[model samples]
Structures are given as structure tokens and as C-alpha cells.
Target: MNRSTVDVTFVVGYLAVAIGLLVARSNPATTYEPSIYTGTPMITWVTFAVALAIAVGMALTCRGREQALGIGLGAITVTGIVSLPVIRNYRFAGMGDALTHLGWTRDIVAGELAPHELFYPAIHSIASVFHYAGGIPIERALLFSMVITFVPFLIFVPLVVRELTGPSMAIGAAAIVSWMVLPINNIATHMGVHTNSNALFLAPVVIFAVFAYLRRRATIERLPLGLSPFSLLVVLSGIGLLLIHPQQMVNIVVLLGAISSVQYIVRRRSDDHPILDHPTMYAHTIVLGVVFGLWALSNERFRDALLILVVGLLTEDVGSGAEVDQRGSSLTEIGGSLGELFVTMFLESAIISLIVGVFVLLVWLGRTRLAPEAKSLVNYLAISMVPLTGMFVVYFVGTPTMAFRQLGFIAVLLTILAGVAISRGVGTLSNYVSRPGGTAIAALGLSICLVLGLMTVFASPMIYDPGQHVTDQKFSGYESGFEHADEDLPHAGMGYDPYRYDHGLNGVEGDGTLSGATVDSGTVDSEAFEDGDYADAYNGIDYYFIMTQYDITRELGVYQELYYSEDTLEEFERSPEANKVISNDEFRMYVVSSTE
Candidate 1:
């Protein structure tokens, strides 16, 4: 077959496999099975291998530099498609954070916001829009939301890399390098962190806006109607990020602020201040701040949360009210924590990409006459890194999990830097080689990138035998327990639905109970339950649904240790007011007979 024919055949065959995997993995018939890997494991692995081979082939056989670059872009797209089914296989609903988002989506669709602590509501709103406007079911809406929030990151990373470093074979390599290196890279498929994931989708758009603003300023062009579209996008995306995830909103603000500051510093040092060099850019920043401030002030909850977060940061006690065991680690201890973090980043990222990033940093540092734009970009990245690093230190001192959330943005920045380094390093190398030699070198780079990309995708904890957040046995038991409780209980005043069991009890309502009202698990004071405060806390509730030992034990460590403790379970069993209404291996429901 001709080269074109081969390419066409490969594309078609890959699509077929992708579609088949989706069908096989999402098949409802086998969803209730005990095994998480329902699809043939061998077939899944083989499909991934084939996709990687095709990506490498495309990169190696491309006729020109652009075509070869397309291979890198294609690898990202292909990896996303091929990895989705593998991640979603035998797991329709994600665990923990994903389950919480799913509950929020259901509440939004039902036109009733649950009277629970409000988190980033934009994700739920987006999913609700999908469900109501598109006439899709909650499951599909949730799935679509996951895809929309995640897939953009894949596209955005490549765009940022290509824009930062002029297009070369290294652009694709850099893209893969970024994907492999990011610690939170698995967020694309993990599906639980709806807010963070959604915020990330807009991160690239913001980066692109910055890129455009810089390019426009360089040419001394006027900000016309054409610029308004991207500016509008930046404004809207900023607002959306603010509503969805506070950390990401802060990241965007910091990034934009850092860029502007760097530009100012550069201009001042050079004694050059051009007139309206970036009119639209400044306008974008002003509008973002004004609108965000107004929106936050308008909502009491948002305003309060903002104040609390700010206060927490200022006080060096981000988890002030939380019942955490905070013995305040020393600076040396904090340094140890940060040390482990850097180690993880180094170990997880592609080694070659790290080397290339070091090379680029060294080369940039050694250069005396760098372009103003490049200098500003480098300075902005450096400035951005400090705040994130500090946030990690603060979180480590206050709350460890909060530090983990901060890793997403840190990973992105590191990935972009690495991509720049890889692109520059490869571009320099290619300059001295013959045409064939360059092509061969590019092919070898592409091959290494493909292998790394594949490892990143398939080896992610989300894809490769992930934790038992959701299983057929667990979900089925949870659903059955809820059904039994609904039938046995008289009122709708149910107590805390621990581990977000409300996703199973969607249409059915017994009492006026809101989901997740009281915290029955986690690092909270379990002493209350042992001291007979449980009955008083859940006084008005008619029924309490609790996850069984099996299901609870199979959950993430924090949740497992919190809820499945022998003392907690013993307290529940011994409570005279709490009569067992329904019991199963996965969950148990008790009737609050005294309250009823």
C-alpha cells in the first residue's frame, strides 16, 4: 500500500478499536461483575501497544516537520481515546471526589441544590446544563463533563509547547514529555476532582491569551474587535475558574500578575515604555478582578469561603477549624516534606525531558542578549514557581491533602518548562545534522516519547488496577441497601449519607434530609459517637445509611481508617435507638426508631 493508504488504514483501524473498546468497557451487562478489569486484560494492553506503535510510526514516516509535529499532537489525542476505556473499564462512577461531583450534578439536574457545604459549583452547573439542555441522562452527563474538563488539558499542553518553542519535531516530543512528567497527569482519567479538572481545561486558554497578548504587544498593534473574542474568553474562563476551583483561580491570577510584573520590570530596566502596548491585556486583568470580586461579594457563601481561605493563608493555619492532628512541623521538617515532593516529581517525569529542561535553563541563564519576551516568560515562570512552592510548604504545615491539590498547577508549570527545554535542545541538535540524519534523530526522539507517553497513560494509578472506589459488588450492595432503607423508613429525614451514597438514592426520597449533612467519617472527632452524641446529632433523622466494613475497608486509606474502626462500628451496633433496618455485605441501614 502507498504511504497515504497506510496512514488512512491506520487511522480507520485505530478509530474502530477505540469505538470497540468504549462499547466493550461501558457495556451495562457486565457492569455488575466483581472484577474491575471486566474486559480482557490482554486485549486492553494490546490495543494500547498498537496505538503507541501507530503514533511512533506516524512520527517517523512524516514527510515534513509539521507532519511530524502532528504525530506528537496525534499521540496526545490518541492516548486520551485509548486510555479512556481502560480507565473507565468496569468503573462507571469514580470514587470519592467523583462521587461527590456526581451527587452535585444530580442535585442541579433536579433543580434543587442540596443544603450541604457548597464547593466549586461551576462543574455541577456545567453538568446540569448538559443534562437539561442536551436531554442526556445523569450518567452520560457526568461522563461528558469528565471528558470536557480533561481532554482540553491534552490539547492545551501541546499548544502551549508549540507556541513557546517554535514548531519543530520537538514540539510533539515536548508534549509527550509534559504529559509523562506531570504528577497530577492522571487527573485526566481519575474523574473525581471535577472542579480542579474543570479549572485545568481553561488553564491553557489563559496561557494562549497571554501568548496572544505578548505577540500583539511585540508588533505594536492596536487592540481591535478581533482581540475582543480572546479577551472575552479569558474573562469568562477566569470567572468560571473562580467559581469552580479557588486554587486554580489563584493560580491564574498569580500567573497573569507575574507576567505583568515581569513585563514592567523588564520595561523599567530598559527605560522603554511603549504606549498602550497591551491595552487589551490590562483590560482583561481589570475585568477579571472586578467581576470576580462582584460575584464573590454577591454570594455570602462564596464571600465567606474567600475570607476563610485568605485568613487561613495569612494565619499560617489553612486548616484552622478542622479537627486534624497538627503538631506544627519545624522548618527543617517542612523542608523534608518539600524534598520528598521534588523527588516524586523527578522520579515520575521522563528522565530525558528533565535533562532537556536543565539544559534549556542552563543555556537561557548563560545567554546575555535574550529577547525581552523570552526574558519575561522565563521570569514569570520563575515567579509563578515560588508561590506554588510556598503554598505546598504552608499546606504541609497545615494540611497535607491541600498540598496535593496544589501539585496540579506546579506540575503544569514544570511540564511547560520541560517542553521548552526539549524543543530547544532538539532544535539545536538538528541544526548540525543532514536531512536524513535529522529525520532519524527526530524518529528516535518520537519513539522514546511514544514509549514514555504510553507508560504515563497505562501506568497511571487511575488506569492500572486502580483502588476500589467503585466496584459492581459495592455499588450493587449500596443500591440495594438504599432501596431497602427507603422502603423500611417512613420519613425523608435521613441522616448523613456517608461516602456519598445519595447517588444510588437519586429519585427516591423518604424524608427532607439533605445529603452529606453531618460528617460520619474522616479525621473528625469520633469520640462524640462513643460518648453518645451520635443520637443527639442525628435526632430528627429517621434512617441512617452506613457503608459496610467490606466497602469501607476497600475505600481510600483516610476514609477506610475513619469509618471502619472497630469502636465506631461497635457504637453503631450497640446504640439502642438505632435498629438495623437493612443489612448487606456492602452497606447497612439503621432506623432511628427513637426519633421516629
Candidate 2:
């Protein structure tokens, strides 16, 4: 067979073996642990690691289109590894956010909530469509939408990277390695069903279009396809971004506005400015900006939320050196382990940061060789980081605006830059060594290991596994508990979300139970059992929930500092003030007698 044919066959065989093994071994966790590998079985992750290693090896080694295909295959498989558990255990994964989204989706489907009623409705709106059209459950549909949003990364990342540095084997590797910044978050940019994360995924399309215009790529000549693909994508994705999460849309608006303003200035000075190639970007940017402004004003939910944020900024000591809160540490605080804290905060993100670092250094080192469009992006990223750093400082010192979430945005842009860096690194290395074959192989091997490691960290709850996708039986216990709750007295979970989503859905007229405030699981399990001490320790609440998730956190010590042991039944059974009103193993709710 020809080399291309052999490469193609290898690629196809690898993809099938990897994906098939993953599916065959993948099953929902019988007993919930934040780590799917331990919860499901050992083989699941072994297969994943093996499959990833092979894919990454080839992605770095193979040449031309075959390599690009390898990168896409590797990326899809890694995404699948992350998403499979959520799909398998669909109902109430990621604790409350998914449930809240489900509730909103349910409302949207039932005609109880209009799409515009929420600021970010594209995900829910699309999920609703998928649920109805595909005849799937609402939860699965949302999960499906979340994974589907990631599909664009495979296309746009490659496109942007290729645009910046021409094409090379490193472009393919970038696709796989870029998953480190997927942006592999548990918060706003989480791989799970987050609306802003979806918006962030589509951001490369906007960036790619901006660069495509610099190349003066032609419009489609056929009827009904008159516009350039970038222009059309800009329009559609611009609207999609606005609907999915306007926070990202606002960034695109600013990006396009800057590009547009430059074009206008260059046009006025010179009839056809060579530097600012895209003449029409100015109008598109202005239109998007106006639409964004109108959206901010018209959406009452967003407006009120913005005002609340404004109040936080106004009340905060922004000028104060951004001191971290000196609150008392919980038993789960890692006990002042600065190294672990730093690893958790920075090490997981080091891959993406390293890529951006390399990219910045390359811009200075090879400035004359870079395309004008790439140079412009470098300048923008540098200028933007000043404000971005300041905002993060303010947020760290306790501002209501969640500045950390913007890392997802920066991560998206950085992934494209990584592509350029990887290709340049390969080229530079190739030029330096006369007999570079062994060194090249070693470098590729190291690259493959990093890709595999990043995928595991980014996708699975390895480094942090306290909170996880809830098991079916465990979720069932909550549903069953809410069904038998007392209407008058208040109830609260010991950690995380407090089962308040279900309470709100049940529309129970209970007092503090519906507020979603949570207590420490340790306080629930080990506090004094004296007449009034036990009751007051639960914070005047009537019911204390000992959840499987809290137990998992308690066991893994992921994010639960104060949460106690998993077998709370023994402890609760010994308590005099607490009565085990609800229990079926996975979940237990103790009714604290107010009379005590």
C-alpha cells in the first residue's frame, strides 16, 4: 500500500479501537466516587490511557492531512472520555448547576419559561429542541448539547493555527494538547454543561474569521452563498454567542470593534489601508456592539445582576493591595499547604500557560517572519492582559465579578497561539539538528505524555474529586427524600447545593429549607449530641442531610475540608436529638427535633 493509504488505515484503525474500547468498558458508577475510574472499574481508564497514548504518538509523528485527522480523532476521544460518565449518569450530575439547568430546560420545554427570560438560553433552547426532536430525556439532551458545542474546537483551532503559521505536523498536536485549556475547568468553563463554556468553545470561529479577512479570502460565488464563510459564520456565531452567553459575546464585540475602528482609521488616512484589510468589519462590529448594548438593557435578569455586581465593585476596596480573605480555615483547607494550593490553582493550568508563554516569546524572537494578522493578535493579548490581571486581583480580594471565569476566554485565544508555537518549535528544532531523528522522537514522546496527562487531569476528577457526577441510586434517594419531607420545618444539606433545586421544583412552602444554604458535613456528623447543642449545631435547621456526594467529598477530601466520614448512619444512629427520619443507605436525612 502507498504511504498515505497506510497512514489512513492506521488512523481509522486507531480511532475505532480507541472509541470502541472506551464505549465497551464505560459504564455508570455503581457506587459514586468523584473519580469515574475507581467508581466504574480499573479497565475503563486503562483503555483510555492506552488509546490516548497511541493517538497522541501518531498525532505528533504523522504528516500532512493524515496527522490533522489523527489530532481530530484524539481530541474527540478525549472529549468522549470526559463526557461519557455524564452521559451514562445523566440525571443529576455536577451537583446542582446541571439540575438547575435541567429545571430551566424543563420550564422551557413546558412553555413555562420563555427563552429570553434567561440571559443565556441558547444551550437550553437547543437542548429543548434536541429533547423534543430526538425524543431523548431533557438531561441527556443538555449533556449532548454540551459535547456538541465542543465540536467547533476541532475545526476552528486547526483553522486558526494553520492561518497563523501555515501548516505543519504540530498543528495536529496542538488540537490534542489544546484540550488542557478546554479550558478543562470545574467552574464556568467546565467541560460539563456550562453555557459560558459553550460560548467559549465557539469563540475561535470569530478569531478565525478575523484572520481569514486579513488573507482576503473570497466569498462563495454561488447563489444564496454570496457572503464569505467567515462573514456568514460571524453573523450566525455572533447571534449564537449572544444567546449562549453574552459575556463572551461582549468580548467578541470588543474584539470586532477594535478591528473595525482600526479599519475605519486606516481607510480614512489611505484609500485602501494595507494593514487593515477588512473594510466591512467596522459595520459588523458597530452592529454587534449596538445589539450587545440593547441586550444588556433589555434583559432584566442580566441588568439586575449587573447592578448587583456594580454594587460589589463600588463597595470593595479596589485600591487595597487585593488581600485574600483571612477567614478561619475549615478542616479541609489542605492545612496551609501552599504547594498543593499552588498546584491546584496553577499547575493544572501550566500547560496552557506554557503554550502562551512560548507563543509570546516566539513573537519577539521571530517578529519579522510573522504574518501581520498574527502580530496584531499578539499585541491585543498583551494589552488585554494588563486589565485582565487587574480584574483578577480585584476578584481575588473579593469582588462580585467572577474574573477567574475569563480564563476560559484567554484559554481559547491561547490554544490558537499554541498551534503557532508548536509548529514553530518543530521547525526550529528541525533546523538546528543535522541527525535529529532520535531527538525528534524523544521530544514527540514527551509531548505525547503531556497530552495524555493533560487529558486525564482536564477531563476526570483526578486532582480534584470531591464533587462528582451523582449516581442514579444516590439521586433517587434525594427524589425519594423530598417526597416524604415535612412541610413546616426547615431542612438543609451539609454540603453543596443543599438539595434545594429539588425543593424549589417541588414548590414546597418550607422556610430556610428552600434557601439552598449548606452546613459542614463534619458539624452534622461530629457536633455535640447534647439536648440543645446538637440542634443548634445544625444552625437552628430542622433537618440535616447526610448526602452521598458529601460523603464522597469527605472520603476523597477533594473540596470538603470540614465534611466528616462517609458512614454517617452510625454517628446519626447514636444521636439523641437527631432522628433518622429518611434513610436507604446512599442518602440520609435526620430530622432534628425542635423540642430539644
> How many collisions per candidate?
7, 1
Candidate 2 per-residue C-alpha lDDT over 1-596 given as tens digits, one digit per residue, 9 for 90 to 100: 37877576666656564655556445655565555555654555565555555566566667776676667666766666656655356454555456667767877887867888777888988899999999987777888888778778767787777766555554665676565544555544566677777788888877777666666566554336365666666767787789988878877776676565555666678764355554467656777888888887888767775666666667756522343332114322645453554455456356556866866776766643556666665555444555555555654444433555666676676666666666556666666664246336534644554554454433244444454465566667766665666655544555454544463243212233333322122234244332225566565556554546545455446544334443443455676767776666567667776444
- Candidate 2 minimal-lDDT segment of 10 residues: 513-522
lDDT of 1 by residue, 279-344 (tens): 435566666667666655677656665566566667654653443333123213323233443343
lDDT of 2: 0.60
* Candidate 2, superposed: residue stretches over 4 Å from native: 1-5, 8-26, 86-90, 217-229, 261-274, 317-336, 361-368, 372-401, 434-465, 503-532, 539-541, 544-546, 555-569
TM-score of each candidate structure, all chains considered together = 0.70, 0.84
lDDT of 1: 0.53
Evaluated at residue 412, the lDDT of candidate 2 is 72
